[model samples]
Target: MPSREVHTATITSDGTGFYITEPVFYAEPNYEKVNYNNYGMAFRIQAPPGAYSVYVKTTSDAADTIVSVSGMETSRLLRGGSWDAAKLVPKKYIATARGKEWTYTYVNGRDYLDIEIEPNKINTPVGVEEIVLQPIPPQQREDGSLPTIFILGDSTVKSYTFDETPMSGWGQVIDAMFNPDKVNVINYSMGGRSFKNAYTEGRFNDILMSGSIGDYVFIQFGHNDESTDEFRRFGRGSTESMYETYIKEIYLPAIRERGMIPVLITPMSRVRGNAAPGYVYTNSFINRKFPDIMKRSAEESGVTLIDLNSESVKFYNEIGVEATTAVVMSIEAGETPGKTNSGSYANGHPSKKIDGTHYKEALAKQFARIIVTELVKKVKAGDSTAAAIASYLKADVRVAALSGDWSKIFPEMAGDTTTGEGAYYRNQIEKLIQLGVMSKDPLGNFNPDEEMTVGEFIRCISKLMNLEKSTFADYPNGELSREIMGAILVDAYHAKFTSKPKYMTDYNGTAVVPGDPDYDPYMDPGSRGAMYYPLVSWQQLMDTAQIAPHLASKVKEAYELGLIRSEKGIARGQMVNGTELEPKVAVTREKAAKALYFMWVLQQAVKAENDVSSLK
Candidate 1:
């Protein structure tokens, strides 16, 4: 299908990609006009009437940057959806926050797809490169056969792009929990708004009219609700108190009268304590008021209640604070990576200061899981209030997996590979998806079996190395020999470390193969197969001809990596089992993705460790 974009500094965003400022300002730029603020750059697109996968390419990179897009809603603090769906992981890791990562998220709404990039902290710039909005004709559903789950909340429940890491909200991943064929989750939250902001603005009344009987509205607040600050406070009357005011007076009544369901979720906890074993709770005021009011309101208002406030605290305290920083915003001066191509990040945006309250995809997914579990519980108990939306939860492997263990980052497989068959790399596949390396294809499918060409592998590795440019895409596309893959990989790694990695034929090899479940070292005794080939070939009554000694090391390394079984059988996505691998065979996309993502993560972790060590 055809696609278009609207660049900043241009009129009618006739679909341009990037500009120095937000769409409302200086219709053009000469580099001197840009400011270093979070909302300085924005993308405005008129997405065609169909389902589409939206991607935002930014010039700036924050570890936990937030990619938010919507229509008909001003920016509130509440976020939506699951962490898995938060497309905020980096295409490459930089020692600094100026690293640019692309965000790929689902697009289904009115014609306008208003996408904005916000740094983890305010006043930080979200540099722009280009915005690609392509409409996928295959997934369009005009018949309204799919139910829509509308989320209304603060920054904690907002839809954040996972490309930025921990900035994602629970509402963002809700859509992934349910089958899209049955429902569409639309997050209409701004990161900072509270009930007072939402209620006073008539947001509930607005939703009441457009929503029908089958639709469900999830309302969560309190993180920003208890603010004594005048600009951020809301819903403060007696009968019109924080949690009670809106749901009792407006939401519950209207939604029920309109034949719909209104589910009330308490706010998730803030990582308000030090990363110690027994940290103090500085956010006690909110913990006390918001949840109490929410529960009371749910009881009095007769709405279904999902107590996330209590659950979040329990989970938070259990994991402790030090680890919480990875989920929230807590990068120290020397701990953060890179100092190049970044200015504002150097000055302290996303510093150890502001990330205390805002959380990311991992936290968001947990919160969503809690909410789904609570909803399912009530629905199963036959709560009249929740009966309307009970069908929204699934009873299949997806739900079972999520409910059974919240630690599993990726949801159950959606399309294929549901059965526990030859999917040894299943865990790796999910990790790749969670890391934003395995996004849905342009046609909106994650076809794991698609053939991965040599060019594609190089491009994938290039992006992982943050060396992606027009050059990598220019590589030849075809099945690659084992030696060729290793040679290309070693070259890239060699350039980064300035240490010439011995060629595949030079060093023993890297990955684990069949005979060597423990990566038993292989030595070239003058010639690789001059001895073994004769014995094996004579025993099997086959030709004594073996893999060329020069190329055989490639086979050996491939074997150790579980890439090949024989001298020519090229295996793709096998685990480190003592099994034979195929050689010189084409690799599948899943296999290629697993390999590149695993290596990238491994290398990045090592780099971060080294960076930390240098500071000490």
Candidate 2:
């Protein structure tokens, strides 16, 4: 294979070779200084098929430094001293400049060479001053001894780039589960590629041409295959029958032709509402039978099968919609950087809108753990193919210790066994606590009968939906009024999903304030204003100015999303011209839970609807 000259390289930000952090906040020139306490820096090195000696010069206030290339186990740790002593003893934290060298044979592709300074493992920062590369001799390179595991699937399994930081696929993180010295993982999965397009686009060919004889190929698809829409792959995606045929006939046979082992994995599930029952949430979606079809195909072909769909569903459902957002790419407004369908935030932080389809690094690692754990089980049951892969798994992954259920994973979410509540909204309150939205005081009392303050409600709702944490920093004291609560709920929903509510302004452009004709606060004739904005849209309540200016938009959105219903406590201020949103009436904790329940239900409904529409 051809090799490029090894030299002291300048780290570029945007090209084929560069250095970047995991969350990708910024890339420093030459990668000399790093501010984050993380194992996130990945530097790309261009190399050919040969063994090489890599020399890295670095100093740190941190206690240790670990460096490893792709397909290699990281075992060496360069020990240092604490930076804290520098305050009293000057130069105590100064970097001990030394060149540490690691020798490894070059792997295929320009993969990232990761330098991990164990995150939170050290309290101080680390700096890498230089990296020098030198090729040893052709004789030193390992000659196709280690078997490679090539991953093929959609966005859920593909490895992401620096720009796409924080978003990782299971294919990318699965490497961590394996003993790198035993196996090499090369992810060929691409975003939006179904069974048909993956073959058509020569992704499969890339694997066949590049991989050795005994390599393993993991095949997973179906997220985009069932689509009838022309937007994805210009309608080249498969139908149900087509998907089945491609898997059993074309995909399996082709892998066998290349003397490769084929492992089939069903597609994972999407995020749904807490209101959805386990059965309904797990099984309901466009082409929901895809998993079943995959199971049947695997049996007929006598291929090793991993049922990730069922496992992932159980995981998402147990966690609930609110908890699931952490793993998926559901970006809240101002969380990182604002992202809407139209454009990005001006400040330019990394953020995305409410994305249910893709997995963040957290979820990707979880799913990866689940997949490997299943393989470990198969090995124990005496499956030859699974044994081949499971043999290479890290010691911890060799055991089936990872649980798909959230409550088992997080004990606090299960709630205190000794305490209980007897309120009418007891179930709702319990669910909220389980979801980490609400908690008990020192006395173990939820105090559900008492009125919920505006500040309290804001914090609970924000935590429940994983909205921008600082969105409502102005959490005012005092009981949240019924109308204000409605506004807050709708506002949070919009901030999360980015769905704008419909509205219109009068042609006369009148600045309407509170206490007008229909909004007359004290029921006095003089309190009634001269002009009134007509309730043009039922989606838009007539007199929004009647509420506080800060809460006016949310109240309008509440009407638009149908979150606010006109009932006894929730009143229409006017008897004739328009509905009056009762702004002064306080909402108790139980009533707040009811409103929150409606909002949660709406979240799942919208997701399900979107899932169905995507199929068309």
Candidate 3:
């Protein structure tokens, strides 16, 4: 058998360090053709700090082998070879580093090794390793607070373990946008279960028992309830009748019994038919009965109704069939399975599959805003007279306008006003600027038409808002580099404004040869990725102004609310220009008009709700 030799070298700033490497086997052996082996070779090396070691461990497959290190030692071994078992071997080596340089060599066959060293004078883990598991405690629910929401549905509302990847149920996202301290949310949903099962199997009862006075319940079903297969189907009318039973027999009685409120939600529509343009009621036969029955039930029960199906349809229609499909589909092109890819359709269900019937976190958040808007409206007509419905409405409008962009909060500065700019966003920007939360640049130019640099854009908003800053002497120039905008970037990162990748180029230094053995082109700027940065950005600024962090807690609060994501698996610092924010993006005066007009409308809605409540 032919074999190859490999060698590796390392250098440390201090004289005390270690070096380790593995040998690469280039030849492919046909295990099936031959009785390859009953055993595999293993190598090990142990050394103290200021010493070096090298070894190789082979596996049947190269990918299965891993190189790892322990304190001041190194080793290599093969895994999954035709061999059934192998004895653990230990080897020790000693070496002297001239200055800070160390080298290692190995002969032939593929193998892996890991190296470890004593804590160098300069290197350390990034802070203490802490894993926070429990949900952050909700802020104080003072004497007066936003109405608590209880969500009850099926897989469409809550996902199954099988459906947890890539897409979380809409309920998860809905729970994120509100202040937990003010609005307590309890999502009681199970995947593959429907309204009938929920009530019969004790889920609904569980919610009722947990309910408190002044709380609100939002109920949506039909996805699983409408399933026609005998094995899974709950029967169409049966589902509707069960819905009625819950409203009259369960929901109403519980609410009235406990002085809580009920809000009926029509089942969100499902995406069906490949050739047809968009999502419709799952089957026309059942659709007519479900929606009408649910609507009537809500009316008869004197409960506020939110037509989620209708709203979803309208919103999808506005975005067009393809865009809507992209929004609903489970998998987008150029994505791997098991990884949550964008554009929805991973499974037949809404979240995992990216179909019209379900929503991804982003869209679920929007839907939640819609539901909250209606709920607030209803609350305004009751005893909560001081509660501003406008706040809810403004939140919806702002979220819709921002579409996840924080920078759009300042319309006068974002400059999205254009004849073609959608009225939705235009109005949001105008209101935000008017509210004095955002402003234009010093040049009297909002630069509404320009793509914002990471530094310029993050810093602009950071300065506008009084965010925290850090100074590090170890950073470039004995001070954290200003050009990199580390201060704002770090703050944004902490606040979840931007995401960094697992591996990112060291942009602070001059570019190195792409293929150099010593070159790690993908070095992350920080340990965490950008998706964790919750703060809004320029593209976000162009969309909605209100979702932008207005207070210090808003940043952390937004993170807890699930309003932001972090780049957990990717690399960072490769110049993420806001492709969505085109340069010279002229803002049409009409767009501005639409924004202001909507803000007025939202404000009026709030005022109206207040008035109604006062009358009560």
Give the top-scoring candidate (lDDT): 2
When 1 and 2 are scored with lDDT, the better candidate is 2
Q: 143, model 1: CA deviation in Å?
A: 7.4
How would you encode candidate 1's per-residue C-alpha lDDT over 299-385 as one tens digit per residue? 876777888878777766655544454455542211111121111111122232545676544456566777777766776688865
lDDT of 3 at 402: 37
* lDDT of all predictions: 0.47, 0.53, 0.37
The runs of at least 3 residues in candidate 2 whose Cα sits more than 4 Å from the true structure, single-residue gaps closed, are 1-144, 229-234, 273-280, 285-288, 338-342, 345-353, 400-616
Candidate 3 per-residue lDDT, tens place, 339-387, comes to 2222111112212233445544334544665665555555555624214
Poorest lDDT segment (10 consecutive residues) of candidate 2: 607-616
TM-score of 2: 0.43
TM per prediction: 0.45, 0.43, 0.39
Candidate number with greatest TM-score: 1
Ranking by TM-score: 1, 2, 3
lDDT of 1 at 411: 43
